[model samples]
Target: MDAPDTAPGTPQAESLEVLYQSPGLPRWRLPPALAALYGSDLGFTEPCLYANFVASLDGVVALGPEYRHSGSTISGREPADRFTMGLLRACADAVVIGAGTLRASPRHHWTPQHVHPSGAADFAELRRRRGRAADPELVVVTARGALPADHPALQTGALVITTATVAAHLRSSLPASCTILAAGQGPALSMREVLDAVHNRGHRVLLTEGGPYLVGQFIAGGLLDELFLTTAPVLAGRIDAARPGLIAGQEFLPALRHPASLASVRRHASYLFLRYQFHRSITDASDILP
Candidate 1:
């Protein structure tokens, strides 16, 4: 079904231009509701993990305390970016995010309909066709279990992947609707365990919308497979020590320079959408094994 342009001032999807795509990348038109925003289908297979993020031209993902959500600030609540996010969520089995990301957007719901209300029915139909749940399961990862229990997203129910110690602390704090998974015994949570827990729950197509630190852990553990980044045209210059880039709390400079190959590129106006697939060497693959 085609999603009409019901929202005023929202950019149409037909405006998007495909610049480049890898040789073997699958290509197909999206459903009518999403076709305007996303021209091609993102035919992701099961047991895959991908991350999505938006940053400014100055490589700043967060604008410190001055801006509530650096992404919204950087993208200026661009309709194309939101549509892309919604489209990704629509194609995923589950939506994952760090606790920091949950706290950052108090009113945000990590669902396709929340971002693109016009495509709500279309998203539902897509989920039905894929044999997925009506809404993608929300998975929140926290090492310390420090989360806003009363947040609307938690109220709707979520799987809290955390450490055993933190899980006990959160048992009574979080609503009964929220299920806590003790992915680790110690004070820290393991990225591998988190993926295992999600995979065990039958969510093989995982999409992580991170807060940098979580993305860094996924990269550090060599668990990340692909990265879908939206480069906003604005330049959010860093004026303080708090502004962060795409990856935080981890360095991959000299020892772990993870290499990735460009998979696809698209553009809408001044915004650029890029997809990079991480190239995992045999050595890196063995390092992540149990």
Candidate 2:
């Protein structure tokens, strides 16, 4: 959705621009909802309920190992993207992920000191702002129970929502802090069920860092509130390949009186980031927020 325009000459609005203009640390830029979080006037909840993520021109997600495939050592470019990816970690009360994604790019809720500059990563403070007294929760959905017990992410604890009918042996090996939340065995824990659980725990702004299938399901289910898309200048040339686009099956944007709306398309050098708010109530992806 298009965020309300910031008033002219205000430091609040400036923070939004300064963050976007900053060259490095992709996760450091402030989100448009920042003002609402700190400002009054709007009731209590974030003005909107949503989730967003950054993907390559080819739609490659950077949640884990594939990030290296996109070139991490490219000097100035990678840091901004990395920071942008990590920044989402701070935005959500709980981060939702698929088992395939977690196994592929295992992550910790808090970026450890060794992973980031000594004083930069603050998991404790971010959670407090969300009204969470402890570390952010990790929601991992798996059809089959296969998460490893020794993965570094366990130290802070996690909620494993699976449909395998039983918990894995890893549950026994892990610390007593972990909890396995069973959400049936169908689509496993339905997206609605998971969101309801997290929302009750004080998270109104949930961010879904996708692994394609998961993104596709949310889009198909009409559960996606908004999307933050960053388009880089370079092209990966997948147009002729005939590979699947977005989701594999047959969900397409329908034609509507106002089918699609473009919120804000901002240019930073050669690249442009465009946000589209899906009006799924009409069952149309084209109906973006103008």
Candidate 3:
């Protein structure tokens, strides 16, 4: 691969080493620097819902609730991983997260520049070429409406989706930039309803950074289309039931199986970036599971 035609004064890092990429993946126009750093251009199907996560070699995505910023810890803040995250955020119309994720990541801003600043200009350029806003809108999903009102990300502005009761309460306290949408009435909102609301807002390409439980909802609802996982070369041994893998709040081992096709693979030193495409139509497990 050739060196990226990075712009002047752009901070440079080791580009992602592409090990394998399946043919026929969608391609988008990326700035030269981004294309070079990412090892290729990236794109997504419109109305697509995708997820991103960094897990330990032992498949631990979170280190229980005692640790803060588990993803950064798990990935060791690998530049290539951050670059991939920024690239994905740059490609989306909205970045969605669950309330638990928001609470866990108190200081995070789900923006392309926030995760990977070196490619700020290039990310902005890509968004412009794709006709997106200066920054992808942030969407937070909450079933109970529990959220930190003063969280910086919330202060920065986000679309908060919750039940009617929660919406009524959050609308009064959250920042003026936040929009509260009432989607359902219950302990949990259906992932389908959440995606429908997001789509209605004209977000064709959605990126979910929600936690395992939320991702499980998407998987259970068959809403997620793809997943980008970065496997850090570290083992987070599971002690009891605290450590959770990529999915939580649901099980799909013996009774049901949802397989993913390898779409691409890249390497950044010890970290391995893997892209997977889910092809099966996985509906509610409640209907299929006994």
Candidate 4:
């Protein structure tokens, strides 16, 4: 990392500037234009569980329940960030999200082309080279089975992982394209079971944009391998506990602290694109959950 910015008259509106990168990162073949815009190629190891998020400088990932789609507000819809999102999606075998996230963005589609239309052809080419499908499958994790049946992402098709009790109801309510995977019989499903189910479906490289609560469960279970965080140039003030940070619904600061190494860093003006690698500790999700 720590490379200079691209020269003027590039195809993209903005290009990422490489600030720092650790040695020996896994990289896949990227389209020339995509690599140029990203300042580098990107890839992940097989059977990887990674997350992507855009947070404010003060580390507020969600504004509040009142604010719908706050991530766009946090990033101001930066072109570089969008392109990075598309790139990540293109590299994943499946894009995972929580039910709340699916409900919050009713019109959103979890695909590479949806986020960055300019890179559609490039992303498709990259996926073709990787022998991936035209689009990554969408996976929605929910225990309560509270989802918008008419959501476009659902109509397009998704894997709804939920409790056994809820799966029956969703099968009748959700669209035919949506596949239901009954994980367990409880108010909450274990993250390990969810990943195992995804793995059984032949999705080795998984990307999650499932908001803070679901991500907290992943971290609590030591299931997350890498985190791609975008530090947008803004501070979201918190008046109450309604606003959540990058991790919520679980605390791990005093007794159990999870450390991560900075894998890479890139920048687009004031926005900082940071990648961190975390080591998995617990063998099973039951180790963390009671």
Clash pairs detected, candidate 1: 13-36, 13-37
Pick by lDDT: 3 or 4, better one: 4
lDDT for each of the candidates?
0.78, 0.46, 0.82, 0.84
160-266, model 2: which lDDT tens digit per residue?
76643655544665567677765555534465565666666666766665455666666655666666665555534443443333443335545422233454454
Instruction: Identify the candidate with maximal TM-score.
Output: 4
Query: What would the TM-score be for candidate 2 when compared with the true structure?
Result: 0.64
List model 4 lDDT by residue over 234-265, tens digit each. 99888755878888788786767788999999
The 10 consecutive residues of candidate 2 with the worst lDDT sum are 1-10
CA deviation > 4 Å runs, candidate 4: 1-12, 282-290
Best by lDDT: 4
Quality of model 3 by C-alpha lDDT: 0.82
Model 1 collision count: 2
RMSD of 2: 9.4
Worst 10 residues of 1 by lDDT: 281-290
RMSD of 4: 4.8
lDDT of 2: 0.46
Cα error of candidate 3 at position 221, Å: 0.7
Better of 1 and 4 by lDDT: 4
